[model samples]
Target: MASVGITPLSAIDWGAPWLEPWRVLGEPLAQRVTATAEPVHAVLQSAVGARLPVGFAPQSELPAGTAYEQHIWDTGRVPTRDNLHDFFNGLVWSQFPQTKRRLNQLQAQALATQGVRAARGPLRDALTVFDENGALLSAPAPLWHALRARDWQRLFVTLRPLWAQAHLILFGHALLEKLVYPRKPMVAHVLQAQNAINKIATWEGWLCAAMEADAWADKPFAPLPVLGVPGWWPANADPGFYADAQVFRPLRATQADARR
Candidate 1:
């Protein structure tokens, strides 16, 4: 796959605070897209296609019963990069298109077997949420298991170093909406890491780092909203937020290294 230049997102003001997730893509691509005055579909297609030759087509063109991700690739009908929601979706496609495709496949499978009901299985519900607005999280397997079990201590404190290995790829519109309100029990894809030392400068770079770690390749990642992470959101401004050792355990004074 070719490499698209992904820049840092430090200087750009994405207008709304919730749109902050775009920073994960770094600056290059984000800044370029925001600065460009052309149609976003063209810009996103050019950027995504520059790296992966496959382009998106209209959803109407796709065959009936096509998997979600395949439809996205086959019909590029994702949110355009022009607005906030679509922009993030477009960025996700550029960074983690394969994983996105896999998510679509799983969502389709779940729908096929279970169909739509008022109450869906945990896995199916999780798949739907992620399909719409979930983040792809790649980390160590232990970390993934810890997240799956909601073992906050292990995930945020004991296994802190593993966090550097943890990568988040935001794709969910609902996830972003939830972020605006900010809530608990945020679920994400628990991807196992393939590399720990790779640097995250751009969305593509972050994707490369996670792909290099590909430890959880082809496996269905479980879900958890990582936004509830202790230091991840500003809502944790309350000292009491971290005081809940059960969910947000406190790190040792010496163990606490400032890095958010």
Candidate 2:
């Protein structure tokens, strides 16, 4: 029962492997949408209960001249819009409250010290990039080296068997939205997880504690064409799938030179 401008829950391919982790929370909320944020808020509240860090408010509730992150920090109310983007955002907040709160805290601190300028400082910029399109990759060392080097063939084929020891979790709301209609070129700014993790809650706790402004300012992310991850997309099973140079680009000569 989606309202105008909202994608129906039934329309989304919940069976998609990428969406499987979030289907539990997303499916029920999608069925409850009806032109307002209240239903979304209610579901979030019931799911997170007192543990919910912020309350969901209509987008119009946000005051003019207020920053989005600051508003969330000051009032603990997230101005939610009735769209797929915000829908996924709310789902992330519910799923990763600790990590979400840490990100907001960093954003608020930056706004307080730096004020809103034409350009967001490096830390804020990095935070936003990760917030909008970040992912976590827990894989073996060799796979990590190959990915960081942008060695697509080695990562996807040569060391393909190592994928059994890997798990990739999408953390960004926008990333989730884009995956609803997956495209081969869709990429994620990936941060490596230090240890093997089996549970989402464990990842959340680790990510929250790992948030560091100085470290993030350097933009330490590896670009990963998500679908290229083994078994995620059937088309990628073909040996020639990585042949698309445009998507599975090798490391730039300049970067390679620097590495040497």
Which candidate has the top score in TM-score? Answer: 2
lDDT (C-alpha, whole model) for all candidates: 0.52, 0.86
Cα error, candidate 1, residue 185 (Å)? 6.4
Question: lDDT of candidate 1?
Answer: 0.52
- Estimate the TM-score of every prediction: 0.52, 0.93
Deviating ranges (above 4 Å) for candidate 1: 1-37, 53-82, 104-126, 136-146, 153-225, 228-231, 234-239, 243-260
Tens-place lDDT per residue, model 1, 76-138, is 465243444444556666656665555555555556777756685666565566556555555
Ten-residue region with minimum lDDT total, candidate 2: 34-43
